[model samples]
Target chain A: MTGDVIASRDNPRIKRLRRLAHEGGAYRREGQVWVEGDHLCAAALAQGHRPEAVIVTPAGMHWVERWRREGGLAADVPVWTVTDAVMGHISPLESPPSVACLLPLAEGTSVRPDVPTVVLDRLQDPGNVGSILRSAAAFGFAQVIALRATAALWSPKVLRAGMGAHFGLHLVEGADAAAVEALRVPLIATSSHQGAWLHTARLPWPCAWLFGHEGQGVDLRWMARATTTVRIIQPGGQESLNVAAAAAICLHASAVSAFGGL
Target chain B: MTGDVIASRDNPRIKRLRRLAHEGGAYRREGQVWVEGDHLCAAALAQGHRPEAVIVTPAGMHWVERWRREGGLAADVPVWTVTDAVMGHISPLESPPSVACLLPLAEGTSVRPDVPTVVLDRLQDPGNVGSILRSAAAFGFAQVIALRATAALWSPKVLRAGMGAHFGLHLVEGADAAAVEALRVPLIATSSHQGAWLHTARLPWPCAWLFGHEGQGVDLRWMARATTTVRIIQPGGQESLNVAAAAAICLHASAVSAFGGL
Candidate 1:
């Protein structure tokens, strides 16, 4: 633990943190990504991922010390004490959390097609992806497969939105319709206007759920291959549901159909 | 109609348009708001609101003129032609649409709580509020009332997330629990871990649906006042549902229970 403080905003490490927070490729280049706040950090440690460096201000250092005393952090991890300005320079949030860390990406797990899954087709919004991931974790969907154009499941916005769900699921991005087609499980596709009304259908348990883009529904190729199409019956006077909201309803319904009351 | 060319970025009209697009307070200060893309402009016009200014690129002007020739925009409305930079500057979207407009906020109608309604409590994210609004509109919830701390319904992020649902339903922001109490209808509050199973319960239709903060559920005072507490039965192994997702399920379930099959 370097007690030497980084007071200058121009410090090379601070510059790297700024780039990592704001841009996509910085993390890949550095072989690490920055995670903000205590909860995410705790979640990472819980998942057995070790932090490379913990950067904090003096007051934040005290908070980190408390975290260590409380058994929230690994005793052996290195902590870097930095000035408040340096901490702010590295934080993605408007108000910096007590700590931020450089952690390696969670390694990809081998994906099995037969497991109940949630497939994202070019779901471009990071927040939507994150919310869907949270729903997937909540409903016990075994995996999340994002089409090539979908937002990165581990991107900063998605990570923030997912809360800690990213640490709990099998997330595979840059996938295609072929991947979904290969799954042996029944595939359920959602639409604003189509297929079976979700509530009335004999929804099968442990089935794959397919959600699509904000403006566009499931991709045409996947739609063609989908065994059945389901629509959440909207009795209201409006048009369609947000894809993420729809995913939550569909996932919850599937979970209940599979396992009973929540 | 003056055919004055506005090529310079420093033009007052252009600067004002940029400000209106970027600043949250711009609309309130100027008594005007910007609507970009054909869909939103069409939605506004359909609601009988006229725009103060219409800025379009040369190509956009040509396309709009063709549409007008084919009986698109109302004939009496004035449309201003502009350069691409001006059009881009006034647009909130990353890829600016061909047309952009500064329109007055439409006068809101009185809240009619006779039908299904959705109430938001201290929802701070503009995107979530917008998505919830879209869900409320789709599920036949007649009105959406946002707590004073809820993101402003008319904020740019919300306006975009909501698509055109803002025009389709009655939206009132800065509301309180008293407003929910005043509905004179049964308030169905959504809970993650308590209450009767949503499906089996004799849920009320056309009822008032209540959702709380992103991190917290409904305020305890509001929860205690709720006529019924209901939860979506999830069988899988997750802690809680995202607030927006929870709202969609509850609202849809209410619609189903009251109206019969979705």
Candidate 2:
């Protein structure tokens, strides 16, 4: 089906797109997220999702055209081709991408207690949180429990940083202490100081790793509750690594210890 | 000594600071970089660096006052108090930080051929470059060689993401292929595909790890020159990991292999 040409910025769909693109939390209210670029949109389709609607600029029409030719999109899904002005008005990026799709936010769900998990405790930076989610998925951590005050899991910045990893993992946002406590797996906390060295530690498999705020570490309560804590030895005497870097190292170590060298 | 209060943003020193804050390569032109926040300032001092001058807003005066009282900063290093308006005008941050220091950029230096090093092959993002620097320091990599197209090492964004890692590492920027090949140690390239698994590789000590662009893998010329190529095992079957995350994982693996668990 041919996409409808939307020339005016005042179009209702364009206004809605603007909100979802600029306001990170607008998705929560509208129950839909705007996924831009082909990599993300394709990832969504690979996961068997049908976009509620598609928005394309002239630059993005080629991808939509190809997908339609390939019968990759359903006939019922609306595709709107907007003018550059309309796209620029709706886009948060300086150089707005050519195409984007609106995907419904998955319904709220409880944490899966048995899988390998990473708990984000009040991580404020969307980039850091999204990178952690990407690392978590790569290293076999299946779930992410983001505590209250953490950057919203589905925010545009987070989604962009995640690079489509969001489509692959189970994420629980705005989780409280009780939700974390309910996990059956051991809670392992990572600290830059005061723990058994990561490579030397006897890491448990199928555990949940708790990484805390960018500056402050895991909450003291979580630290006290942890079954074990691991420290990544900083041989150069730097005080700490970036939180996402720390998570990648720690998660990789756990994956190696449990499943042997990748 | 009491600080001179500069109330106007048009002051010459304030103008210089605004340039450094807003332009990533302004440091190269000005021969100095602006270090912001108490954490970064303290990190510099801890490394025995004395700022050429200090700029403080009212919000930042208390620390400067405490430092002067404690005899931490030198008598000759001028501290200028600026109005909040002046600070806001110079600062790129939404809520401008209370204080920043001007440090002279060190003269260009060549890489130490035999030390563990990281070769950034045109990675574009300042955050990625800075995060890799932080990881390099944490994992015992003593030197970082950023290729010609990579983000500048002393850029404000990189400095912020580095979180003081720049002070501890030997950084050589704008390097070419000749500079990279001059290193005496092995060139170890990391790829998401077509390499020995990282965990099982016989990781050589004091090797130079090549991490490439965010969108592309290492330039094929460099890839073919690598003594050994290693890939991180991604059990989740994800196509690729973020460049910085990959760097942290690869560098940490090398550190662990070279030095027994810390």
Candidate 3:
């Protein structure tokens, strides 16, 4: 059943949702993330995540009810109605969504050595981080480890950029390089300079790919741990590729190589 | 010689620079774009762009002088020093750069029919537009045609996302689908559904790539003109890849195939 309307911006729960939307690290402290829009909510449900609560604007009530009828939303979950102005206050986007939900952050999982994983080392851009997650998920890398300085994976910007990939990923944030080193799979570092060409190289499948900060390449500690380094050849002579672009090219190459012979 | 320091944010030139930084279409109105940071400035110079003027903070004077000595800046171009606060006021970035330049926009060029080209069809994200530009430049696609509904190619955000690839590109914005249809090379449309897998397809070298809006895939009008449609396979079952990521993979694949036998 739906709960009472929360029309006030001053409501304590609304304030917390607003915080979660604006601050990346707030999710860590509050133990929940605010996922906006029906696409993301459906994705979370598809991934078997139970929303702690759903907040919808008056105009969105019909859509939420439709979702409930379609089994996209749980019948038992409480839905709170908020005024359009209150929805705007809680949204971080320029165009506020009609609906949003508070979902608990998945419990942190240890790196699984045998499974393919992606290690993000101090990536600062939320878009790049989220894009990489989507690429990783698309290419069969089921796990992602974000090193200490990486953007908060649950941040609203990242969630929006991730485009629902977050629901399917086993994301480990604020991880140490040491934790990554403990994984048994071979680590592959991507370099813009001084490595065998990726297209020509014999890449390792089920390996851990280490992507770094925008300005900095993979850290020395991570580089030292790399079983091999690969470079994407730029025949047209641009200095380097964008980090997210680089990740997709590398991941797709790996995926193709892995599946090409089968 | 360096001109007088601008300590006041109200200075006419500084106000214009701030406008150029914050507004997407300001470059079109003012006939100039502000390029911030040394990397972008150097890239512009390397591409034979003549800066109308150079603006730097007090601490950045030495670097500008060195650039001048090295011939990165033209001797006749006026150099103005601004206080750090004034510099901040002229920058849209969270961290302001010490140096920036007011460079005249390249005269609008018509889409060259013979050159390898990338067409933007109502793509709105500044970063995606920029990233695709970088991929185009890196893959030897020297011309980019942005359809009328696409994001402003010369905008500050797109320029920054482009990472200096703008200097090397022949970009035509506010273009129509008919202009793209007139290109001599085969038009390749990227689709998330119902197309040959990109990796397995025989991609044409120096063809035109049509990238579409983030939410709406390539328009049917453009799709109808396509000689072929290619899809990037996603073994991991995601619906689609980010447009930028898709561009990189497709471009890089074309590059490799073109150069592989040579």
Q: Give the lDDT of residue B202 in candidate 1.
A: 86
- Two-way DockQ contest, 1 vs 2, winner: 2
Q: Is candidate 2 or candidate 3 better by lDDT?
A: 3
**Candidate 1 — which pairs collide?**
A236-B139, A236-B140, A262-B233, A262-B234
Rank order (by TM-score, best first): 3, 2, 1
User: Which residue pairs in model 2 clash with each other?
Assistant: none
Give model 2's docking category: medium
The digit string of per-residue lDDT tens for model 2 on A1-262 reads 3446788988888899899998978988999999988888887777678898888888887888777677777767888888888888888989888889999888876989899999999998888888899888888889999999899899999999999899888889889988898899999998766788887888888999999998887889888989998888777785588888889888888888777743
Model 1, TM vs. native: 0.90
User: In CAPRI terms, where does candidate 3 land?
Assistant: medium
Q: What residue pairs clash in candidate 3, if any at all?
A: none
Candidate 1 lDDT, A190-256, residue by residue in tens: 8667788888878876688888888877888888777888888777654778899899888878877
Q: Which stretches of candidate 3 lie over 4 Å from their true place?
A: A1-3
The best-first sequence of candidates by lDDT reads 3, 2, 1
Question: What's the lDDT for candidate 1?
Answer: 0.77
**How close is every model to the real structure, measured as TM-score?**
0.90, 0.96, 0.97
